[model samples]
Target: MDTRNITYFMAVFDHLHFTKAAEHLGISQPTLSQQIRLLEAELGMPLFDRIGKKVVATEAGSLLYQYGMKMLQAERDAKSAMKELLSEKRGTVRLAVLPSDLDFQLVPLFVEFKTHYPEINLKAFSTIFVREEVLSHKVDLGIGLRGPADKRLVQVPLGSEPYELFVHSDSELAKKSEVTLEELTQHALVMYPKGYLGRDLVDDVCKKHGFELDTVMEVGSASSLLQLVEAGIGATIQPRGLLKQHSTWPNIVSIPISGPAPIRHLELTYYANRFVSKAHKQLSEWLIDFFKARTS
Candidate 1:
């Protein structure tokens, strides 16, 4: 079986349209159709059912699609392993992290990592969809909240941190050592927009408590949200580590959330079967140790 034909078949299966799949594959529709027919003939069975304008994968095609993904991933891993044999220190480690952590926490660690392993190219970016990015193979590793069970991913526990109320020193709420979820709703708050993982986690806790946070502002940027709290515009709820790492902003004080605090359990996730180059392994170990030190 030709991997090229399997690739074409997967494209068509994903799109469910011959022309669209062909366009995505950068091939002519007729050429893609012919390739599919060849693949079907080789398998001795029809791979797809074309009814009117619809295209649906047959049972055999569906089973093959699952294995096809693994086969392609294996091919990629083989190529990567061969390339790494030349030099273990010279490679790229792509990472995706939460926006809040990226903005306020990880810069120093990243700088330290780069200083030691300057030869290893590090491509790290902030995103809300950390799990999705890792699963799609867009990044070699991801740092985010704990994700649901998936056999393809191996999630190493990073650490758990509680979300605390942040406010300027002059704010009345800052005088209190702690605040309950109900009391938190009474005060004006600034938070991440809906659909963000952080915001969704906080919102879920609020819903369980039978009240919603009265957010006066919804800022997508973590820095901006902290800025608002620093300026006394509105208080915000975030991981305690955010303010702890950045002591430059002395005015912002973090107050613990009493009565079922919203805790964010973080993990370092990567594909279970993906090749782990030396550079990748080093970075992963460093990240795990970094979090452990912080929590300790």
Candidate 2:
């Protein structure tokens, strides 16, 4: 079937009204009606049911609508990707990331990437569920904690960032150069909401060490968690890089996790067989060296 027919069907499905769909498509109502009739005749079945003035999809129409959406999206994406290839100079890479890693991981890496490919547009969204966006193919790449189930995504473990306990300088724990999970659990815990990698790591450590964390409060972002810890609300454990910018906060202390330090492996994930533009490949290579330099 022609893509224009698919586009017309999608336009109708979206608006569910003949006149509105035609208006959106910049075509006259009768032309849109004729196209729909032709599509139905081609399929040998009526696609929509006219109930008074309202339009509703028939059984075949619903199925066609589903496939039509996918086809049109794929077409648009293919055109966009091809345009980027033809240009050979610039393109956009959509990226989704967890909020906690925004400043330390994403922002710096984006800046470094833009320095080389200044024309490459990076569209980034900071949220907890970047994986979903990647899964839906809405974003070209993702940076976040790995999920439980394996799929088609290719994940490259960049490096694991260790977690550190934060305490106010005047607090007794601040006197120590390093603090263990056991020691940290002795105080009230300020933490992230459940399902966060850092919070889960802290919980796992506390469980293994035969103690339950005294979680006094939970916040959404790492920055806010650090702010709460600095205010002496309670101590919290977070990735080491989170401490970099907040290093100068007065009365703030970062104590390394003792024993087997729980580390969250940062990964660069993308579709296994999906197209990787020149800019994307360069950014990926840069990340490899970037993390290596930091770890080294």
Candidate 3:
């Protein structure tokens, strides 16, 4: 009848030993036995059979076990739903972000967010397609250089960061602290695939500059592209924030670009009209402020 009684019964059923069940439940053996007896009395049936020191489930107990699991699961779900309704006290927040954002941007924001809401569990990952992850419901939130996501998703524009080129110090392009898109494009380009929001901007910039890109490699992540550039393989473009952070890379030269001055609008997006808990709102606002403060 009582949820606690069901839980105790399940524990006893699992162990099939009174002492072990009592130990597992952190209740005294006599107390556990008395509770089980009371539960059996309430149900009007014997729940267990004692043969020597071991206890085995009777027909009634086996049937209760079947229903008890569902009862516990339902109870747990109810509590979670209630918490989400009340305070958004606890739940997992699956998040997708770009690798460059992880170290400098999202990670710090997450640190502050957790400080405020320690009960919120987080799973943050970096991938090329954060928008798709959010749209498919694989992640509750996504952070990236925002572009056109599915109309079904909601976007919260955080801020914008200018894109720049990362070239090896010895490269001819590195001679200039600032270069035009046409100048940067002269070398082999190591960049994310065209599907990526940042890469799409790069493609547009290249087209506007009147040149088809000499994309030598279409890597999935900014880190890999940066590595290729760092190895003196070619020049790659990335956000200025990432370029500044890795500016100390021995042979890396991060040069600002000027033309249309392409800027990436970073956004936090989630499914539109989904039941966003208060915790989610609070965390999202915290992130908005965090990026705003950093980028400002």
Candidate 4:
């Protein structure tokens, strides 16, 4: 039997009312009735039994309904699969990044990306452990300062941005365009709260220099930490790219951290074992290209 006739039969079977089924199917009731009759004639049995105004499926009709459900689902599945294969619809990509990275114009870059690929959806978030999110397979992509990620994941390096010393304009370090980590250590430090990447980086560097960091203040958030630094409470170190992000900060001097300068590499990473969807791959490539153009 034709699939259209089968579909019409199921519609009538569901509604059990010719006029209602026809209206739902966007067809005339007489046309629906004629289609049902044609299907019944082909089957050599009455699919539905009607008594006065009531309608009920017969034994044959009950059996057909069971198969009809599967048939419609299979058709839909096939169409959807084809659409995906053709890239007719670009699906969603789950991405995790650092809050500082967001200030680096990543959000606007994603907006531009979405403009080109209208069907592709990009859901982004900021968290300290972007690498951990990728390791756990909780996200499709992670864009952040690279650290010890699981070697099992594929890391695509975007570029590296050097860390700079953020001090008050009147500070001695401000007199020089470049300062060493050892020199920045002479000033009181206001670092990010413990367990943060920036804090860990500074602590590790200081340890290598045979001294532990003595933080005068530890702020939980970047904005709040910058606020304290803006008030000249203490000096801090951050990526040059990150400093540019909050470029409106007043009375701040970002001197380059020279003499064995520690740097953070920005990267996009994904699980190596899992299938990388087209959306994920495209976004990753776009990020690398965008950063290259930016740093160039």
Candidate 5:
């Protein structure tokens, strides 16, 4: 029941060898072995099977191992959250955000977060599948086009915006106030690679019309894709926010997606009911307000 015993059990369960586990724990082999024996005795079943020199968890031990790992991790997280909350002056908030051309959204939010919490170190990862990262404790927070289905995540509604078609100011598409899904398929396109959210949406629209997109180029960054468009290589489609802050770009122009447009939702998500530090709480509040403000 004691955490020390739990730790000892996990250590053994991880290494599957008493001596290595004891070495890692900085305890002697015999002492760790004795503790394991005591734990097995108290449980009324063998926790491990000794096959020659190798050790493997018994069926009961495997079940308990799962619970034990969660317990220790929860304890560690509790201590960390308490430390940050009680200290008040500084802490770290690890965040994962989709690399979905985040300059217009994430950059400003980060600037605001830094200005308010000057002492808090914000470590961010540019990634997709933001929800899984938070659940596994890989990061404390995330922002993405879509959030996780798991109940652990608390979603903060960020604004939604319609997709825009980008073309060189001299291009035919730019001459129109809006571009239809059918009209778009007439031109060659440049966009993110397949499997990305933006590309997936565009592909779906094309499919709905019983056609596939004429994607001539596939680049990774938004700026690069826009540059290619600006050079009149191909047209591109993306969220309006990706280019909102770059209003001065002379050649690139955006037109609305016509004929029943598809909109993408932006959201900030964090683990629900988990002990967050003081800085995290304030930042989460600020983020909610900031995103909600965008909606308004």
Candidate 6:
């Protein structure tokens, strides 16, 4: 089977829509269809079945997809290995990080990595769906909250930190070193929407304690949430590490939550079996050490 055709097939399989897959591949829809047809003819079996507006993969297509990913990964590994034979320091490492304080907090570390390996290209971005990006092979590494068990992934626990109350320095709650969950509910709060990872962590803890938070506003951006708190709108609960980054902002205060505080556990995850290039391996090791130093 042609590797190029296998690549096209996988794209179609992923989207289950010819037009969308074509768009993603930067090819015209007709061209994409022709490629699929050629691939099917070579295989001597139908790869996809069209049912009305939907496209579904056949058993043959499903089986091919499994091997197709491995084939693509092998091609990548070969290219990386050949490149390193010429210059050991050259390659790209795409990384996705949590779309919260953790994203911005890691900038210094990223910069340090770049300084050490100037030839390697580093592309980093923030997203709430870090695991999804890594799992889909869109990113080589992910730093985010713990995810559901997946044998295809290898997760290295970074560390866990407790959620603390962030309030304007002028607020009475800021005068205390810590506050109980019950006392915290007495105050108005600004929080992320229900489905957000950080919000869910807080919500789960509150549910276990038999009372809900008195949330006055729901904001999605972590920086916006802190801005609202600084404006004295309402308090927000976030990991203490987040507050540490904003320590220079005199108006905001971080108060620990007393008794069974909600904790956010983070991990660095990647494909368990995917090839690890030298640049990728170096950055991963650096990050592991960086987090270790921070938590220690």
TM-score of each: 0.86, 0.72, 0.60, 0.62, 0.75, 0.89
Candidate 2 residue runs with Cα over 4 Å from true position? 2-77, 103-105, 147-151, 208-210, 245-251, 294-296
Candidate 5, residues 250-281, lDDT tens digits: the string is 88988988785567788888878566777787
The C-alpha local distance difference test score for the whole of candidate 2 amounts to 0.78
lDDT tens readout by residue for model 4, 112-205? 7788779977788788788888765557788877666566788887887777888888777679978777775568988887788877777777
Candidate 4: residue pairs that collide? none
- What's the TM for model 5? 0.75
What lDDT score belongs to each candidate, Candidate 1 first? 0.87, 0.78, 0.78, 0.77, 0.79, 0.86
Residue clash pairs of candidate 1? none
List, residue by residue over 1-296, the lDDT tens digit for candidate 1: 87788889989988999999999999999999999999989989998999999998999889888788877777777877887887666667899999887876778878888887788889998998899889877789999888788898999988888888999999999899899878976788999999988898899998997888889999888899988998888999988777766777889998998997789888999999889988788789988987766655
Off by over 4 Å in 5: 1-69, 101-104, 146-150, 293-296
Better of 2 and 4 by TM-score: 2
Could you give candidate 3's per-residue lDDT for residues 179-295 as a string of tens digits?
888765567888877677677787887788677677888887666777798898899888777754443477887788876667878888987845666666887777777666545
Off by over 4 Å in 1: 51-54, 112-121, 125-138, 147-152
Top of the candidates by lDDT: 1
Model 3, residue 205: distance off in Å is: 2.2
Q: Is candidate 1 or candidate 2 better by lDDT?
A: 1
- Candidate 1 to truth, TM: 0.86
Q: RMSDs, each prediction? A: 2.7, 4.8, 11.2, 13.9, 4.8, 2.3
lDDT at 235, model 2:
84
- lDDT: worst 10-residue window of model 5: 99-108
